[model samples]
Target: MNQSFELTPNRLRELRGFAIAARLLNFSRAAHEAGCTPSVLSRRIAALEEAVGGKLFLRTTRRVTLTPRGEQLLAHCERLDAVMLAMAAELRPQGGEPAGRLCVHLPGAYGRLCVAPVLARFLAGHPQIRIEAVYDDAYVDLVAGRIDLALRVGRLADSQLVARQVGSMRRYLCAAPSYLAAAPALHDPAELKAHRCVAFSGLRTGTLWQFSQGRRRRSVRIDPVLSCNDSMATREALLAGVGIGIQGDYMADPLVAAGQLARVLPEWELSTSPIQLVWLPGADRAPALRALIDFLSSEL
Candidate 1:
């Protein structure tokens, strides 16, 4: 005799709730994806936890993080992407050429020295593409600022946005020959405290210069005689023999070779920071932005 049983889909709902929560790793964000309130999402997740007999997330005031069980389950679930591009002749118009205004952001010095030249070629190649480039040292919110793309330096934290590393950034501790001659002998990073330092007020790491020698690392707090937020002004001060300053490779390399500035602390070096081409979460679906990103990654 066959046993009478009612088939239920509570498990399916539980799986879906768990999947969205695990992907976003935040109740609010996952709730947005599920088209539900965060409180409702929380209850769904709780029901899922009870059905699975384990807690799936570690909740906190700041953020929600996945537990081991959540990680394992997420590893098996298919990826959910914000950007999906379908390339087909059926989807193309008479002229499928991508054309539009593309707004981009970059650091002032990096944009002028490195990116502008490449962007020049990209614009020349695409006649219909117009660009509005904003150069600022401050980090701008892609969504709030309505920026389509940006070139970023250094390490990036985990985010829903996509990043593609294109190149590297190198910084050096440098001074003019006159300043080095007038200043005291500076062989170690500890000596920076004794010498005059030109600080860039824009450094995310503050006034301290961090260095690494072999496996050992050290950070020295700087006391600057002159501080400037502008890279050009800082470079001028370093060239004027006012004080030692950390300079980007683009500006320092050419000048150093010409004997305008000397690189200090040759033994201790700053790690190479990454140059990333970053964009919004769903921006890959945009043809113009995608082309520009590809062009930059290839040229740079």
Candidate 2:
């Protein structure tokens, strides 16, 4: 009869391989992280499953997701890894400042002017940290796309995602000097019906221009002569004297300054949109994520 439990090399290797694979959720990514190939990683997972007599993954060509049992095992693995890392850091002679890869998503306009400056200084201060910035207007799925942080505009939907208000932006009604010269004098939002209005299709307002006067707010529907999905295109149309336009302040500021576009109804403020920095709730603990938030909050 055996008195002591024998250590098995196959079981130990499988345990390590499974933990890494589970953490990444992609065989190719896990293999790359482990300095191996996907084929080898797949074989390791298969061997691990055979040893445990249970399947750990459900494979598909397009996506790799965690199974019920895999999620449970992943939690345990994460805890164990955290404990080990903590122990290692405590035992090490000197572990200086926080450092890691921070993935951030930003709008194209804000990223160029606002985010870039802050990131430059942040990188200089924290030499060890790497920033991955994704700038786009399209919707991104954070968890599935592996995004660490995102910058958003306008009202936010009620959700589990954590948000921090960075600043506010306003929309302005503008037209070229030449175009406004020939058009009828605009006194109110209702007058937009007579003037040719250039529309950006992305704006949620349904062919309706909303404005505010003192404490009163009103929405007036209009028939725009031209429409485009992008602000850049709309700006071009306005430059060509196609029609008047409603656009964001940041995009309008330069044109307004250059006298290419004139802001109409400046005294009356319309809708004000808020800028926000959004991230997954639990990602606060991640060093890179925290660093980015701190940098942006201070700079923006």
Candidate 3:
């Protein structure tokens, strides 16, 4: 035969009683406010104290005050209550917009030119969502850093993250007219070997330059005295007549347009890298993320 058992409402009732007692500070007043007798309220508070194995309140003849632990617990309970209320508000669904913090990571140049404008437009549309944008060239660990999404360029390394191809980008070999005039005339890919090469040197092979013409592809190795990891620094060095450097159109576009830098080897098939927006699978599909991606796709 199964024995009959009833679940206890002791804990929740006790907490309710404690909440009242803490607010009112007087047992009689708390009892009246909680719709229970003073004796019942006292017993409930005692049971709550016993169940938690800690005295939550210090009582005097005239007043009742919370202990340090009780204060901390009260603060936490207040926060929990606030969150519950917010959740309820969200559940109401009165044509409300998505509102929360959005964190994004992007490569440096693209962040400034491409992502920044998209972000600006997104922010304009959804004034509720707060944005935190981080720009860097180094590959950031999205999972470890809790990044909502990343705008990654070029060939992606093997990873578990899902990616959406937003657009394409190409690198170009360019030099200032002054430098091209002062330096030896580069007529062919073979002549690049004789010219001073300003290398970004992030890759393993520093001097190796790849070029293609129709079906013919050639890689020429040269010596570069100036090498740096920072792309902006490399661009500046190229501008300062350090040497001819190959960089992406994102960086080279303004300079090329201004005639500060001229695109070389237009006939040669140059290496091109794709611009992709990447995010982890099973991550929060926030409206902010969707809005950002849509804005970028439309703009870029």
Each candidate structure's TM-score, on Cα atoms with residue i matched to residue i, is: 0.72, 0.65, 0.65
The most accurate candidate by TM-score is: 1
- By summed lDDT, which 10 consecutive residues of candidate 1 come out lowest? 1-10
Range of the 10 consecutive residues with the lowest summed lDDT in candidate 3: 1-10
CA shift of 60, model 2, Å: 49
Q: Model 2 residue 188 lDDT?
A: 78
Candidate 3 structure quality by residue, lDDT tens digits, 1-300: 013312154555566667767766788887766656788778877776665567889988877899876676567556755775687566633566766787899877668877898788788988788989998887888878889888887777734555778889888798888788888877788888788888876543457888888899888887886887767878988888877888888889999999999887778767877888877642434555666766777787
Stronger candidate by TM-score (1 vs 2): 1
Off by over 4 Å in 1: 1-94
Which candidate number would show the highest lDDT if scored against the true structure?
1
In angstroms, give how far residue 169 of model 1 lies from its true place: 1.2
Assess candidate 1 and give its lDDT. 0.80
lDDT tens digits, residue span 240-260, model 1 = 999999988988999999999
